[model samples]
Target: MKVFICERKMEVNYNIAEVYINKILFSHFWFHLLSLGLRMILSCLSSFRTLVNKSNPIASRNQSC
Candidate 1:
């Protein structure tokens, strides 16, 4: 009957929506993780640069008697 067909169509639409939402969530999770990793790497690089600069200036300074 028409009612049974309509019910089937709604079920199919619900399943399709669920799949789409899941894919969006999965991609969001990866994007978040990637950004966090990049932030950590950038912080590490900046700290190393500071350490190198500090050491370089101290090593080159002339000692006063």
Candidate 2:
């Protein structure tokens, strides 16, 4: 009876550990994905700004030239 009780306690501990590890892994995955998305957004915005700046002078100078 004692051995059975001990085994049960160990099983419960193992399950709890597994759940905690999975939660940590899931959080890390989401964090990496969020970081990647932010980088992509920033890259796109920078490109758009460059394009706007490049065209602004051309459009303005055409009237005088």
Candidate 3:
């Protein structure tokens, strides 16, 4: 009877460990995805800024003129 109880406890511990590992993995994946999305947004904004600056002559011309 004692051995059976020990076995059950071990199984429960294993299951809990598995759940914890999965949660950690999922959180890491989500963080990486969020970082990648932020980088893409920043890159697009930078490109848009460059495009706007290039098209605006006043940006390049001397302000005194």
Candidate 4:
């Protein structure tokens, strides 16, 4: 009976470890996804800003005229 109880304890410990590892993996996945999303957003914003600057001719207009 004691051996059976010990085996059960080990199983429970294994399950707990599995859950902890899964949580770490899940968070890592989310962190990677968030970083990728942020990078995409920054790139898009920079491109849009470049487009706006190119279309805005006020900067090149002569003030002396």
Largest TM-score belongs to which candidate?
Answer: 1
Q: How does each model score on TM-score?
A: 0.83, 0.81, 0.73, 0.70
User: How much lDDT does each candidate structure score?
Assistant: 0.94, 0.98, 0.94, 0.93
**Residue 29's lDDT in candidate 2:** 97
- Residue-level lDDT of model 4, residues 1-65, one tens digit each, is 99999999999999999999999999999999999999999999999999988866665564434
lDDT: worst 10-residue window of model 3: 56-65
Q: Sort by TM-score, best first: what order?
A: 1, 2, 3, 4
lDDT agreement of model 2 with the native: 0.98
lDDT of 2 by residue, 1-65 (tens): 99999999999999999999999999999999999999999999999999999999998999779
Predicted structure 1, TM vs. truth = 0.83
lDDT per residue as tens, model 3, 1-65: 99999999999999999999999999999999999999999999999999988877775576647
Clashing pairs in 4: none
- How many Å off is the CA of 4 in candidate 2? 2.2
Off by over 4 Å in 4: 57-65
- The better-scoring model by TM-score among 1 and 4 is 1
Error of 4 at 2 (Å): 2.6
Backbone clash numbers for all candidates listed: 0, 0, 0, 0
Residue runs of model 3 more than 4 Å from their true location after superposition = 58-65
Question: Candidate 2: which pairs clash?
Answer: none
